[model samples]
Target: MPAEQKSGAARALAELSDFSMKIARGQRMLDRVKDEHVQIATADKEIVFREDKTTLYRYKSTAERKVSVPVLVAYGQIGRYTMTDLQEDRSMLRNLLALGVDVYAVDWGSPSRSDRWLKFEDYVDVYLNDCIEFICREHGIEAINLLGICEGGVFSLCYAALNPERVKNLILTITPVDFHQDQAEGRVNHGLLNLWTRGMSDDDVDRLIEASGNLPGELTGYVFSQMTPGATLSKYNVGLLDTFDDEKKLLNFLRMEKWLADRPHHPGEAAKQLLINLYKNNEMIRGEFQLGERTVDLSDISMPVLNVYAKDDHIIPPKTTQALRDAVGTSDYQEIGLEGGHVGVFVSGKSQGVLAKGIVEWLSERDAPSARD
Candidate 1:
């Protein structure tokens, strides 16, 4: 055969294979999209309680235990807590519950135009304290274990610092204490936040809030994508392709996709404070930060703290999370390094046994009757 003819045949074969793969990929995406439609329709089954503004999720478990400890799960404000309950099999909430934990997750419910003026102080001093008190009061316990995720972990740290006596055990997962930009990727540029907020008045901020009625998820997702451009595109494509076959896997994949893409618009003033104090100024970890009238000094947090960090996390680098080891005053502190990225720490199978088990064991150890006495 002539070399030119042979080469042309090879290229044609490659093109046909690629076309087949594209068709398969399109069908998979459609299936996942359909799965998401069903999930949204049945979101109510997952809810346990709803008050005026807060929606709390109850994780049911049949595990028999000697001492049951109530846990308050605090997740990031930008995303919903359903990420922890992505699926029955891979759900962190279910996993914890199965370990004989009485878990109650906090859902801040979508913020409305009226909430745009809300500040960090409101979260740390008002909502967090109230939630802790409510859970303790309801359970007839003096204190409860607090497990915080991402920004929620930051909130937990502040809460523990302010009211250490109310927190029996503190578990911080993929939480960022050090806001050093050099160590982190996808960090919000304070300059950009300031630039965005400087020209805006209270009315303008209010208008943006009223227009969206809690910032739409699309806008927040875009900001996150900008943090790691290539990784976001490449990794998710790989993930979607990898889980294309199994329906159960596909459901979990789509749920995480919905949660990831469904970022909420944080209230402008509150976001402004977070960007300035943490991202721009790096104050919270520095002990110079003040939330309302209360000061946030890690040294004031003397309760038992369990710090877990995702080794491959880029958004909140391991170093950034690990900084809590030195920053906190808790003499009983333990840091465990997990083999996964930010999202992987919760979703990846590698995390199921290690990270999830670590959480159960740590809480059990801390809540042991002897440990308290």
Candidate 2:
């Protein structure tokens, strides 16, 4: 071989070796990630209280309750409630369970072509209300506490407004109230997005729902990615490469990945109304929204309310959630600001101590009954 050609071949082999090493590092990270599944198996006594259109997982505390109140776990239709229980040690459910709170989570199952015809009213009127009634009946109690997270928080707020008599207390975490807030400043203007998204008719959304039993995770993932173009890509790149060697870090990343991909389809009409009323028109805050046959007036809720938000939340701005104090009739309301973004409010180490501690403390205060009442 020529001397120059021999040198060139040697350089090429070195470059190939470098690329191979990089690939090996990434594969090793994936292997470590898979090994640490952090299974969030609940120790509290559990039973499926209801299984129909929506399944309700009921968890009871063995510790005697000075106040035997039930907490309904309402989460977004697009994702699983397990994000609250993403890891064993980091689980909100486990924390609440240890606090001796009776818990029931509503699992909105995967919808089918037959379910495409179901409307938002069906969810509010039939499913949610039924779940409330079921819990109340099972315990022979007049009311139950409502713990709403993200979209579920919105649902719980509406439910509390509609059926004030049935709510013992309301807990809203990272719940968006005002949709008209400006998005140019890094906040998600759900109202504007809703305005644009609702242009798709209920039927149009239904077709997507019908075509795929549970809406494809890829489609939802794409929409979320589009919401923040550069930031998401950079974060994923960093997460994959930076934590490639740390076993625990890799598992945390993998768990988050699994939760992000485990999205469920939003019920067609419910999704449409969400975009139109809550996101587009900002009707919930405006007192113009109706749940089932009940006209929801936020002021109707007389129960103790604890509204929590993340200070650095871009998805739902603090201003968006801050209006709750003014909207509700309860004088015993409190607002807590935790340090983190929307997702971080529950998952991050900083928030776990601050936000979680504040929530449990707030619940404790209202746990006691007033002598006047």
Q: Against the hidden reference, what TM-scores do the models get?
A: 0.82, 0.82
lDDT of each: 0.73, 0.73
Q: Model 2 segments beyond 4 Å from truth? A: 1-26, 32-45, 60-67, 183-217, 368-373
Candidate 1 TM-score over all chains jointly: 0.82
- Candidate 2 lDDT over 1-373, as tens digits, reads 9999999999999989876786688787665544336453344545565545688888666555534577888887766787887776667776677666777888777765556556656766678889988888777777888889988888888888878888888999988887765353454433334334546665665566557653565677777766666767887776566666566776777777777877776765576567667776788889988765667789988999999888877667787788888999999998888887778877775655565456667777777432212
Residue 174, model 1: Cα distance from true site in angstroms: 1.2
* Residue 140 alpha-carbon offset, candidate 2, angstroms: 2.5
lDDT (Cα, 0-100) at 307 in candidate 2: 93
Candidate 2, number of clashes: 1
Count clashes in each candidate, considering only residues at least 3 apart in sequence or on different chains.
0, 1
C-alpha RMSD of each candidate structure in angstroms? 4.6, 4.8
Residue pairs with backbone overlap in model 2? 191-279
Model 1 lDDT at residue 325: 82
lDDT of 1 at 354: 76
